[model samples]
Target: MEKVTISAAAREGIGVKGALSKIRAEKKIPAVIYGGQKEPVSVTVSVKDLDKIVKAGKNTLVEMDLNGAKELALVKEIQYHAVTDNPIHADFQRVSMKDKMDVVVPLKLEGTPADVANYGAIIEHILREIEVRALVSAIPHEIVLDITPMTINKGLVAGDIKLPEGVELITDAEAPVVHLAIPKEEEAPAPAPAADAAAAQPESSSTKGKKDEEGNLTKDAAKK
Candidate 1:
């Protein structure tokens, strides 16, 4: 994958309480670059630039220009504000072009499966991404799979994907990536049982006592 170049400035006072907030107020977010057998460096990058990379993909290979020095890295994690949802901080893992690393690449389906139209089968994308081991330069931004020929009940597993040369799948081979499923018919809810009006009604207090043929309450109960 081609690397995207982004500019960053070295930052300090990471332990200071308001230091991070001060960076954000200036339209930048705090970030750190670590790994690759080097000491971690604290830095800050423009919020706009970081957001663009995030929107493209987290696995996007980046070339961080820290002042005059250049470093290759991958966006590992991003912390967001709880209420505003804005990015608060980011972690970038330093990478080497010569070393093989495992990274997740997004999966994209190219076409509708045959069964979708012929049998009304629904296409289920079981795996949205897959982990693969490859050199930084060989890592793919996304993997596209063609599903046009698939039929109902048919599926494509991770092993079925055609990886680019030098890229090896790290995910399980048997793990499902896409499947054409039969749509389930929604059963009509059972009709509620008819209510028995007489059984449901409570006996009125006025009619609680037995009456004689003359329609007068029994004398024995009336006395009570």
Candidate 2:
């Protein structure tokens, strides 16, 4: 895990309706740092810096320099603008190196399963992220899984994942992670216009000369 240092300044007028808007207009994001048994502190950080932290992936360890009072923290949560999809607010949780914390990390699959080419198999990635408990220094940025050995009708469960030393899996071990399935064969189309045309036709020349038992001229004969 890479530790990144970011600069932040104290924020005032938190409850003021437009205080956050004004901070955003200046290319700064409002944030709060809480937990680790200390009072939460409201602060503002550069939008550019916050974006870097986000791009680093979930549970990124960051050294927050709040006016020279350094604190080890993790990027806990972020709120984004619905319209622009830009981050508007962020939450940082204070942490200690000795404490074990549970955090969700992304899963990355590597290599193509051989069944995909051999039998036109489809790979389904059921779980994209997994929760783990570990010290801040032991947590990984992402978990990489090698799927090259998977075969058709085969699947991998959460227990199959390999965790780093000191990291404990918090997600259910029985949860499915990925599966390889064979593609279903498409059914042939039914023969169109299935009704028999001969049976559906009205009486034709074959029946024109025939008369009924009543001895009255048949409708076709009368027309003739």
> Which numbered prediction scores highest in lDDT against the true structure?
2
lDDT (10s digit) by residue, model 1, range 86-193: 999999999988999999989999998767888888888999999999988898889989889887756899999999999999999999999988889999999999
Flag regions of model 2 displaced more than 4 Å. 202-224
lDDT of each: 0.88, 0.90
Candidate No. with top TM-score:
2
Q: Candidate 2: deviation at residue 193, Å? A: 4.7
The residue-by-residue lDDT of candidate 2 on 167-206, one tens digit each, is 9999999999999988799999988877765467656675
Give the distance in Å from residue 192's predicted Cα in candidate 1 to where it truly belongs.
7.6
Candidate 2: residue pairs that collide:
none
